[model samples]
Target: MLNIKYDIVGSFLRPSQIKTARAQYANGEISLAELRAVEDEAISDLVEKEAAHGLKFVTDGEFRRRWWHLDWLKEFDGFTTEHLDIERGGVINHIELGYITGKIFYDPDRSHPEIEAYDFLHKEAGKYPGITAKKCISGPNMILVDNYLQLGIKEVPYYGSDVEGLIEDIAIAYQNAIKDLYAHGCRYLQIDDTSWTYMIDEKFLQKVASLGYKKEEVLDWFQRVSTKALEGRPEDMVIATHFCKGNFKGNPLFSGFYDTVAPIISRIPYDGFFVEYDDERSGSFEPWAVLKGSDATFVAGLISTKNPELESLEDLKRRYAEAKAVVGDNIALSPQCGFASVEEGNCIDEETQWKKIDLLVSCKDFI
Candidate 1:
């Protein structure tokens, strides 16, 4: 079993230097190498901060990319993005929709940017003894949702109406990517997914029904695809999935209880689960009983990354105790989600973000 006591959901706020460097690169003011140098320095600094704050695992803060999921998803062979006039936040204002143009596949011969980024992170975090470099990628279900379900496209060029075929291909692509990352020295991997949380919303379920699909089938597909993607994972590699309720511009996109989907989520063969419980919107901790007797570690997200208000230690301890009552002692602590799911980040500032981290570190004894 994984023994991590305190953790993060991955993706920290992008520093100003990295943001400016990206703009300069886009406008042709700086070359790709120059932009990378800036990102390298910023990531190094972020890793140092995470270590200094006493986190056992360190991430590059996902500093190099704009959107948490799209940047990684679009890297695959068959996926593409279409730019739209829509914008998300004030700092970095751009929106794009992803689509599948061809059969999804992972070509091992091609260089993967996320793998390269993990190489840098692994080396940098290696500087501090006992610090594990964690790599966070968008989960396979996100690809299924963004490319097919959300677009209301039941058929594609290659798969046509064969939805199960599409799911299998996505799973295979992820399996290949996971294997590739493992070869690159990634031991701790986290997959961030919002589809499971989206399923909790009635309207989202309605949409699925409107598209001639049953909610139960979609849930089963999510579990099957997730399990298939993790096929052949080494015994030492620890994989976790974070179910986020949407963190954009300090606002949440969905809110409801996890009761309906808890059993389905518990069935996925992940080593750990990063669940959001920062507010009343998440409902009671009763649903966590589904994980009872399971070996998976449960990271209860008690602090809110979307706001600057620090959580009271006593209250946090109380919540953790409540969760432990239902899920047993394999619980860890973390913020509800990443500080920034997008480039603009939540409404909170950097100082506030670190303060929140400090609070999480301070609560390590609860485990």
Candidate 2:
């Protein structure tokens, strides 16, 4: 029974101070304590700013981490990351996580490392009575692809040829993590995923085939794992999933609509969806026909986060009009994605980023 009309995808452009502090910490010039102190102050200021802008939920701006997903990935026990410098857009190259190595599992009684950040965020958000603090984590399916399936690596010496069983362990881990998070007072959680978006793109679909994964089977796998992850959560806990098509230096790795994957996405048990609809690259609202009548809400990402250029309000209204025509009142609005999926951020200043958020908030008046 949670509702929010205007929201964000749970990240903001990292401030210069945070970028500098992280670099200093990496170079051994600063202590972990020093870096965390800087993060605390930046997050405190960020929550206040988000509240002032009329945001119903606030994040730490994801300022304390490097890549949003990798930070959380490392928190789990059985995963190790290798750095692989990958070419993105040919002009901008950055580190991409190589295939993760290890078996994934979780003891249900164990505490999540991320709980500390939520503790801090919950306290900070309490300062603003009506605003909820949101925690965004990488979903189970994304973890499977990022760690094993995409790289064609099998879980060796342990559960080899048992991919389905491995998926069960991942979902159980996700459930344990969610339960722990709710215990720590988190009411809003977003599972950031890119795997579902990959399925809709033709090129990535070919890649999936090349990797020995059938598109239909993988889609069903993603749905089952995602649903299992949300099991046994508190009735009041609000969980949503953000479907992202690779966001690096403001360039999308794939371009396509949700036509092929709509049926599966529509059935995810999460309370809501934060879907990308920024431009034609995301295709038309034809998928809404399938998404209609679901109990879940839809946060149409009509606003763009890839660049600083403001979207024409007229264009957004026109698109929303089409979407609403299909889904009716189950729809809400947000940016297509986070301002920065990683620490480097989109090619926009913090001011431009805030303005993008302001645009989302103000557009609610006319919509």
Q: Which prediction has the highest lDDT against the true structure?
A: 1
* Candidate 2 lDDT by residue in tens digits, 1-367: 2387889998888887898999999999999899999999999999999999989889988887778787776766566567766655565465656343456665546655578888999999999988899999988787777755556676543557787877787788788788888888988999898888878888877878887778889888899998888889888899988986888767787778788887787777878888998877877777767757767887899888896789988888888888888876778899999988888888888888888899899887866
In model 2, what is the error at residue 48, expressed in angstroms? 0.7
Candidate 1 per-residue lDDT over residues 135-180, each given as its tens digit? 9999999877876668877777788888789889999999989888
Regions of candidate 1 where Cα sits further than 4 Å from its true position? 86-93
- Worst ten-residue run, lDDT, model 1? 85-94
lDDT of 2 at 191: 89
CA lDDT of 221 in candidate 1? Answer: 84
Reference-based TM-score of each model? 0.97, 0.95
- RMSD in angstroms, all models? 1.8, 1.7
